[model samples]
Target: MSRTVAWTPEATETFDIIVELIETKWGFASAQKFVRTANQTILTLASHPEMFVTVKGQTIRRAFITKQTSLFYEITEQQIILLYFWDNRQEPIL
Candidate 1:
C-alpha cells in the first residue's frame, strides 16, 4: 500500500519561506513550478518512500526538489513525515 505524507510545522514553515524566496529571487512562474514539482515529488514518495537515499546512519531520507532545494523526510510504517525543506546552497543541517 502507498503510505501517506505529512508535513511537520517546521517543514511547512520552511516550505513557505523557500517558495517566497524563490518568488523574490526568481519569479512567480518559477515559484509555481517549484510547488508543482514538490507536489509530484510528494506523490512519488507516497508510493516509493525509499526511492531517495537515506542519510548516513540516520532514519531520514533526502530528496532534491530542485537544484537549490531539498526535502528531508522520515519514513514510518504508515506515513512519510516531512522534516524540513533545506536550501542546498547553505550548510548541511544533518
Candidate 2:
C-alpha cells in the first residue's frame, strides 16, 4: 500500500517561501509549475519510500533535476515533510 503524506507547518512555510521566491524571480506561471513539480515529486516518494536513504536515523531524500531546483524532504511513518528547496546554483545547507 502507498504511504500517506502530510505536510508539517514548517513544510508549508517552506513551500510558501518557495512560491514567493519563484514568483519574484520568474513569474506566476513558473511558480505554478514549481508547485506542480513539487507535488509530483512528493507523490513519487510516497509510492516508493525505499528510494530514500536515512539521515541521522531519519529518512531524508532529495529529488534533483537538471536545469531545475532540487527538493529536500523527510519521510516518517505518517507523513512526508518537505524541508526545503535549493537552487542548483547554490550549495545545500544539509
Q: What lDDT does each candidate get?
A: 0.95, 0.72
Looking at model 1, residue 38 earns an lDDT score of 98
Please give the distance, in angstroms, between residue 64's alpha carbon in candidate 1 and its true position after superposition.
0.8
What tens digits encode model 1's per-residue C-alpha lDDT throughout 1-94? 7998999999999999999999999999999999999999999999999999999879999999999999999999999999999999999878
Cα-based TM-score, every candidate: 0.97, 0.73
Pairs of residues at least 3 apart in sequence or in different chains that clash in candidate 2: none
Q: What's the count of clashing pairs in each model shown?
A: 0, 0
Give the poorly placed runs of model 2, Cα more than 4 Å off: 52-58, 65-68, 88-90
Instruction: Give a tens-digit lDDT track for model 2, residues 1-94.
Output: 5688777676677678868988999999999988888778778878886675655564677765226677667767766666666676776566
Candidate 2 Cα deviation (angstroms), residue 7: 1.0
